[model samples]
Target chain A: MTIKLHCFGESGNAYKVALALELAGLDWQPVFVDFFNGETRTEDWRARVNPMGEVPVLQDGDMTLTQSGAMLDHIARTTGKLDGDRSEILRWLFWDNHKFSTQIGMTRFLMNFLPEAKRPQPVIDFQLGRLKAAYGVLDAQLKGRDWLVGRDVTIADLSCCGYLYYPEPFGFDRADWPEIDRWLNNIQSLPGWKHPYDLMPRAAAA
Target chain B: MTIKLHCFGESGNAYKVALALELAGLDWQPVFVDFFNGETRTEDWRARVNPMGEVPVLQDGDMTLTQSGAMLDHIARTTGKLDGDRSEILRWLFWDNHKFSTQIGMTRFLMNFLPEAKRPQPVIDFQLGRLKAAYGVLDAQLKGRDWLVGRDVTIADLSCCGYLYYPEPFGFDRADWPEIDRWLNNIQSLPGWKHPYDLMPRAAAA
Candidate 1:
């Protein structure tokens, strides 16, 4: 009874759940979604996999969950490994979805995935500014702590680190933020951490 | 011992928590933040309220919480209402934060809040297009349903309806989406419901 995650390699949101699954040693396998080829845009895919037309849809037994934050919460609850201060963990997860990963996902897509002519410079600049602010909040939060919530590596770590590990140019240079760099290293130092590309199938070279 | 919410009238994220508190009949008051000015940008405010420099920070006794989704969970937990289908509700909350309200908030800010010359037209156009897709997803979900999750009116409703009730032109025309319009009416019919401006104080007339 392996949990199947409907995801693609380019999705940091998907990687959040994938990282958690790998860390927890859950019986799970990645189900590739050909996003760049427009597989998710199909009506049949929408009705069957996810109506939201998004990735990282976790199918566990009869239950299917969308939104990487919610899926991470389910993984934390089921495995009981990354479950720490409830409110603190939830706050960070929500923040990651609403701000951090959301911005990085789009910025990275525009910078690396989209055609060069179609890349909107103004939009990219605006997003980069906002992401710098988001990076500041995350870096400040990690000033003295290894993990986001408590001393343990909760889903908060997995959630916030969704897009940071990607090799693409998403306006994120690890050397720019010392504390976040250290924190990411701490997460990389986990037992069974896998890079996003190694965990899920990528649609393209980017 | 009434709860205090550090918020502004214009923030949809703040309005989510405000709606939950009002619907739950909680003894709470809105402590206005001068976001239209430089209040939230100040280091002192960042340290005292939220390092994220965002609004809708709920202070219940000594416990303070940021991110509207997290605060709504608190209100739901405390009032014993709007607490149905934990995973489903969380999914929608995350969706709203990640997609719906996030885009509307930015689009509305550019369309109305920001100075005319300062508004980024390319960015606004980009966000408006994305907001249309988000609206389509929401409208489709509400086609034959009265609420986002479960039969009961959960925090999902409160969260998704955050920016919809605003008068600002965020590219959302009620007549365009019939299902979403009907669902919005259903929420408006809820007892003790208040519009964003009515629920909290605005900085200036827009």
Candidate 2:
């Protein structure tokens, strides 16, 4: 049976799972969630789809999974290719969720998705400052290593690169960190790689 | 050799690991990090300890691990308790890291740690709003359940409960969310439970 991913193009969290699915060569398809229209917030959607009210839910027959980090773990375990030091992979994934991707997702939403007049300037500035600190750690970690763990590309790589490919300004400039720049290039060079927009059903389908 | 956890009282991240260690019956000790004095970010501290410049690093002989979520997993696996549905456990762990604990940590820092005049009101307000939504999800999930995943208590509970115990003002009141409040009580009533300040050496102690 083909796996179904409930996702949206604008969601980097969704993109992380999508990237892992594509790279693993899984039989999967995207079912876009109209996040911008508040579909996920609806009571019916929450009860039936995911009570957590988050996207990128993977439907594998009777089994359903949410959280991109957990989804990546499922994919890696099933395929046995992306697995690395379990603790290390989880460390980076948790860090990305805690510090990196979460900050960028909200920062980008404020900077690009919110109406110009409604944008909270103070919140954006605060998030941008935090993002810089997170980026510094990631870039420095990548300086002497080819992968996040003692490995060739793991889910940590797929997880951290989730929000960086979007054109929207989230205070992230690849050119600003040479190590991250090279790492991005390395991920881009992988076979069967696709940008988030190219791989998922976009919110507006533009 | 005893497991060494580099932590401080103010860090709820470290508290998650500390709780896991105590419950798992692991012999461990907390080595304080002077976060309030900017020790984690100094060049020497970063070089010698965690390059990520963060606390809650677990040093067990030749193996060292960072990230509280991962540290919990290590403790759980090593001691053979607190394990549950892998994907479900991870989902809540990620949600706690991405939305619950991280938001509270920052909001509390802004509200309590920063000088009164330096606090950014708008940022605090925005984060408070986001935190309310996260708390709603958690409270609803715990409406009839005693734990975050499965029938037994797991690291997910430990992870999500990390920041809720702090006395600092981050706009959270246990009375406001009955389910979450009850769930917190459950965790607190666990055997060998200790407050974060009691479990770890405080920053001011230095």
- Please give, as one word, the docking class of candidate 1: high
**For every candidate, what share of the true interface contacts is present?**
0.76, 0.96
- Per-residue lDDT tens digits for candidate 1, residues A7-63, read 999899999999999999899999999999998999999989988788879999999
The per-model lDDT (C-alpha) reads 0.90, 0.90
- The alpha-carbon lDDT assigned to residue B117 of candidate 1 equals 90
Q: lDDT score, residue A150, model 1?
A: 80
DockQ winner: 2
Quote the lDDT for B116 in model 1.
98
- The CA lDDT at A139 in model 1 is 92
lDDT of 2 at B28: 88
